[model samples]
Target: MTAVIDKKKCNGCGLCALYCPLDVIYMEDGIGHVVYPDECWHCGACRQECAKGAVRFEFGAMMLAV
Candidate 1:
């Protein structure tokens, strides 16, 4: 599984980047982007910490419904 960043919902607050323990998430051009998806620990820190609910888990062909 990998974390997906919603471009529409993301305000580029860098909260996910700050919350990510593995330093996988980063801000680029005022947007949240993943630097290394494989490095994700799946600890759900980025997803849970995002108050805007922009970050989500992508599992195969399905995405976590909030």
Candidate 2:
């Protein structure tokens, strides 16, 4: 799954970058961006931690159940 960030909703909190287990997310010009999408574990930690709901999943909703 890909973690997509909405620049409109993103407040540049950097939480997604900080909390990502794989250390894939990073802040670029105060915007959250994924650096290593192929390593994503779909753990939903980024989505869950984003208070503004800026981070989202492109697929694998069922994997979140586990």
Candidate 3:
């Protein structure tokens, strides 16, 4: 899974970056950016912590298989 932030919806609250356990998110120009996507644990912390609901998870085809 990958975390994607919508720049239009993001309020630049920085909560996503703060809540990321692996420090995958970083703040730049007051916006949360996924700087280390490879390090993300797919824990959903960033998405959950986003008050504006800017963060979303994108699952790959392999993860969608049942």
Ranking the candidates on lDDT from highest down gives 2, 1, 3
**Which segments of candidate 1 are over 4 A away from where they belong?**
60-66
**Could you tell me the lDDT of residue 1 within candidate 2?**
72
Cα distance off (Å), candidate 3, residue 1: 1.2
How many steric overlaps are in each model, in order? 0, 0, 0
Superposed Cα deviation of residue 58, candidate 3 (Å): 1.2
Output the lDDT of residue 56, model 2: 81
* Inter-residue clash pairs, candidate 1: none
Alpha-carbon TM-score of each model against the true structure: 0.84, 0.83, 0.84
Query: Could you give candidate 1's per-residue lDDT for residues 1-66 as a string of tens digits?
Result: 889999999998898999899999989999899889989989898888888899998774444554
- RMSD, one per candidate, in order: 4.4, 4.4, 2.1
Can you list the residue pairs that collide in candidate 2? none
Expressed as tens digits, the lDDT of each residue in 1-66 for candidate 3 is 889899999889999988888889999997889888778788988888788989998876777995
The global Cα lDDT (0 to 1) of model 1 is 0.88
lDDT of 3 at 45: 87
- Of the candidates numbered 1 and 3, which has the greater lDDT value? 1
Deviation from native of the Cα of residue 62 in model 2, angstroms: 17
